[model samples]
Target: MSTQAKRATIYFDPDIHKALKIKSLETSRSITDLVNQAVKEALSDDVEDILSFEERKNEPLISYDQMVKKLRKDGRI
Candidate 1:
């Protein structure tokens, strides 16, 4: 978290907005904090996925049809 924050305008569905309000009250946190945390977590997941792809960049690629045939041969599909 940073001491300074940026502001943005976001629109949510009515149900989602209501849910956020309820969660904020129950958790004693502001909607801004909750949304920021969620966004940070999503970005972290993306970073992880990118790192994983880079790590396995040299692995052989398998086509979908090939994969299905292999699975059937192995009695897995």
Candidate 2:
């Protein structure tokens, strides 16, 4: 967490807002902290996916039709 924080207005659905308030009281943490953590986790997953795609970028590509045919031939579909 940073000592200095920026403020922003976020509108959450009524049910979600109620859930966050309950979670905040139960965990003794602010809604902002929970939202920030969730955002960070989502961004981290995206970065991992991007890296995986980069690693497989040079692999041979297969079309959907070709894949189904191959699967049928292999008796796996």
Candidate 3:
């Protein structure tokens, strides 16, 4: 455990809690380690999503009516 790690009170559903316990025993890892890794992965995905949005922030915005018109023009609607 890292000395700088903070403590949190998290609640999990009974089924998930049981699964975590089983996984911990099988993998010889702590529940905290598994949860931390999951959280890190989730946050990393969020960061990637945010970066994607930022990259597209200046892209064109098409209105619903305009989209429908284009679809009609292209015989796609």
Candidate 4:
């Protein structure tokens, strides 16, 4: 991992880019900082999701149709 940040070019939809610019100005933060923080948060969420899936890897699988049938049989549907 590099301590220094590397520069990369990313494209955003026109409307989203406009919103980011407005948000950056309103927050008194650079667009770079906001974008980096958003990216970091998203990546963190992904890591958490992966860990949760790994932890639940051995759980049983059930189908939607089976669940509905069971519910109907139990008179709960």
Residue 7 of model 3 has an lDDT of: 85
lDDT string for model 2 (1-77, tens) is 75888889999999999999999999999999999989999999999999999999999999999999999999998
Best by TM-score: 2
In what order do the candidates fall by lDDT, top score first?
A: 3, 1, 2, 4
The all-Cα superposition gives candidate 4 an RMSD in Å to the true structure of: 2.3
Model 1 residue-pair collision total = 0
Which lDDT tens digits does candidate 1 get at residues 1-77?
A: 55888779999999999999999999999999999999989999999999999999999999999999999999998
- Model 2 global lDDT (CA atoms, 0 to 1): 0.96
Give per-candidate clash totals.
0, 0, 0, 0
Off by over 4 Å in 3: 1-3, 75-77
Q: Tell me which residue pairs clash in candidate 3.
A: none
Candidates by TM-score, descending order? 2, 1, 3, 4
| lDDT of every model, 2 decimals | 0.96, 0.96, 0.97, 0.93
Over 1-77, each residue of candidate 3 has an lDDT whose tens digit, in order, gives 65799989999999999999999999999999999999999999999999999999999999999999999999997
Q: What are the runs in model 1 whose C-alpha is more than 4 Å off?
A: none
lDDT for model 4, on a 0 to 1 scale? 0.93
Worst 10 residues of 1 by lDDT: 1-10
